[model samples]
Each structure stands twice: as structure tokens, then as C-alpha cells.
Target: MRIPTVLLLACIPATAFAQQAQPETGSEWEVSSGVEYESGDYGTGTGTDIEILSVPSRLGMTIGRVQMIAAIPYHRIEGPSDVIPGNVLGLPLLPQPQPEADSVTRNGWGDLELGATYALPVKAVNFSLSGSIKLPTAENDLGTGETDYTIGAEVSKAISDKIIPFASFSYTLPGSPEGISLQDRYAVTGGMATWLGRKTQLSASYRYGENPDAAVTDDQRVQLGLNQWVGSGLSIGVYGSAGLSKGAPDQSVGLRIGFALD
Candidate 1:
């Protein structure tokens, strides 16, 4: 089955933190778009392989210390129909692999996510509390077909104006289809970012998450990213991740471009 896709790295708060020490205050707006590809064999030596291609776009605005964001993602899946269900977002929590003869391919819009984050300075650290909801806007089987909620907090501190360290923790409660009981899940992330020059930055992070399905293993991943300011409120970034556990994709890579509007 496909695993839960973690888009935390592409989210507004994470991007802002990587570019600066804290979230921007006052009034600002941003638009970003990116595409990602992931391919892996996930079926515990069953040779069940899947590939996913996704394009996610986001619009965000900051008012005072509050940041609001809206995102939509489109997904395409290719694999054996049994291993990768048609219309399912990526992979189901539990694998329901069918025979190799039932292979299928599907593509469609996924889900919509809306989120808000409130930030404040505490001593030398910038702290943010955020919450989000996922709307079941995709066609049946293309999404969970249920709403999901998440709450999280993040803290970051800068050292000597060149190095920044941050940590975040979040919990998610998912709503599943009838007869399916999905467990609550939690994730933790720790990372550091450093300025390479006046306008370039490099970062690395580790992420761990508890599996929502008892039958599957927990998730572990390591990510490396770079962001460069192209001048005049524009930035470009690239990122890659490798899975450290079976619950995550074997490898993923993506590119993003963002623009700021005052």
C-alpha cells in the first residue's frame, strides 16, 4: 500500500523558517508551486512497487503574527491495481494487493488543505502554534473520503546569525471509510539550517512518525534542502529525501519556486 505523503517541508511555516529565523510579521502574501516524484517497493519483500507523481500549489498570506495558507495537490499513481488502489490518494494504510493481472493506472486531484499558524517570540526562540484541516474534495478513491485534522507546534532559534535550529511536533487524527478504524498518529521533526552566503541557504532534517496502521511499520526519513534568493522577493529551492524505514518511500525529490508580494 502507499504510505502517507508528508508535505511538511513544502508548507508555508517550514519554508519561512528555513529562509529566516522566524515567520514574517505585518502583511505579506506568497504563492508557491512544486512537483514531486517518489518511487519505491513497499510490500515487505512482495515485490510490489509503486510510483507517485504529485503537483502541489499553495497560496499564503500573513497578517500580523497569523499566517493562513490554502493548498491543493494533484496526484498520479501507476502500479499493480491490487498494490496501488485506483482513486486512492497514494497508498492505503493497509495493503489490499490484488493479483498482478489487475494492474491499473489512475490520476486525479487529491485533497485540499487549509491551515493557520500563529507565531510569537519567546526569549531567544520563535514559537508557532498551528492547526489545519483536510477537506475531502477529491473523487472517491482518490482521497480518504473523510476529513482530517492536525495540530502542531514549532520552535526555532538562531545562533550567531548564521546557524538556525528548529524542532516541531504534530498530531493527526484521520477519518476513515466505514468499517475502517484508523489510529491517531504523531510526527516529530528536528533540523538545522545555515546561511551559505548572503542569499543562499542549506538545511537538513530528520523526521519520524508513528504508523496509523498497526500492520505497517513506523515512518522515518532524512531530508536535505537548499534555498537561494534570486532577488526581488523571489526564491527557488530543491529538496531530496531518503526513507529510513519501510513506512516511507524509498526516495523522493522535488523543486519549488516562490514569490513574495507586499
Candidate 2:
């Protein structure tokens, strides 16, 4: 399955919102769309670099403490056919080795993802439980043509007015494709965010996870982001990541713009 890199960018603004005061007792709607581009060899010795351009859009609604979300992405991929796009926020699962060929490019819609999350705040700490499912909505090769499920938990605490620390863990159960057995995946992330002012926030995080194929090294990465809020409901952010192991992307950068609907 291919994961859109915009998901990483969207988190920055959400983190900023989470650090703010409690929400009003009502229903709220949010919509976000962004384009992300990334290039990396993914540690493939073939020396062929895969470039991915994704235009992802998401819609979400919150009622009480529960939030529901849906996302669909369009992707244009350029590289060797043997190299598949990996999960941007977690480990990259390697595909079965095939005969080497000239560089090829493919572009089309990616898989659809639907999810729900519930959040609770007790005193100073906030906690959340989330789950998502990936639908096989893309054409052959753009997706696995199989379904996948993920469950996660996250916690964050504000130690000061300007600083907030957070941690998250997730487990993914991926469907195996024809003639291949994919292992379950899990990841852990720890990070902190600091406010530079009332509307500007900076964040940094580290992630570690297992690759679907046990033969490869584990995934490790460090990510940084900066977000600025415009007016009351618009947010803009820039994010970057550096890979620490062979199972991760060498480098990535993305931008996101989000708007909250009243």
C-alpha cells in the first residue's frame, strides 16, 4: 500500500490545535488539501531514485469527543517498476525482486483511507484512540487491491505555556498480496512542540518502526516542522524528514494548507 506524504504535514497544525484550550461543546468540520513531493532511492542498491508527487485531500468532522475523517489522494510516481512507494510516516515494505527494467512512470489515484478517533482530556494530559482502514480504490499496481487496518494511541501533556510533549504508538495489519506474505507493522513516535508566539509553533520528532519484510533493516527517522496560523481558522505549515536507516526515505519536504469550517 502507498501512503501519502501529506499526512505528515497535516499533523503539525493538529498538534498546535491540541495544545490549545478545550474545544467548545459542539460539532465542527475541517478540510485540508496539499501537494507533496519526495525523492529517494529507499536504500535500493539499484541506484534508481523514485520520485513521488502526491496531491492529497481530507475531510473531517468532530461531534463531541469523536472525530471522523476520510482521505483520497492522487499520485504520480517515476522510477523503476520494481521500486514501490513506501509508508511516509512508518516503515517501507519492500516488494518481491523482479527483473530490472528501464525507468518507468505511473500516475493515477491512490487508495482511500477512512478513520475515526476519540479524544479525552483529564486535567493536564490529553489522550486519544484512533483507528483507520485502507480501501482498495486505486487501479492495479497503484494499490495492493487489498484492505489494511491500523489502530493507534497517543498522549500529550503541556509542561509549560509554550512547550508540549507528546508520544504515539500504532499497529498496522496489512493484507498480503498474491504470492507474498507481508508481516504486521508497528511504529512508535516521540516528539515535542514549542510555541514561538500565539500563532507560530515549531515541532520535532523521532520515529522507529519495523519493516513489513523482516529481511530488511528497521526504519528510523527524524522529522521537523513549523506551522503558522493565519487569522482564526487558516493554517500553513512546512515539514521535512531525514532518514536514519536503510528502511526509510533519504530526505523529504512538504507543505500543507488547512482550513477549519464553522
Candidate achieving the largest TM-score = 2
lDDT tens digits, residue span 112-197, model 2: 88988777755566777888898878753777667889898878888888898888888989887775567888988889888898
lDDT of 1 by residue, 1-262 (tens): 1100122347222633533533444667777888878766553344656777888888887776677888887878776553322111233443453434343577878788898887765565777888889888875366667888889988877776778887888888888766555688888888887879877778888988776666667778898888777777677888888999887779889988877777
> TM-scores for all candidates?
0.86, 0.89
Model 1 stretches astray by more than 4 angstroms: 1-26, 43-46, 80-95, 99-101
For lDDT, the strongest prediction is 2
What lDDT does the true structure give each of the candidates?
0.68, 0.70
Clashing pairs in 2: none
Error of 2 at 252 (Å): 0.8
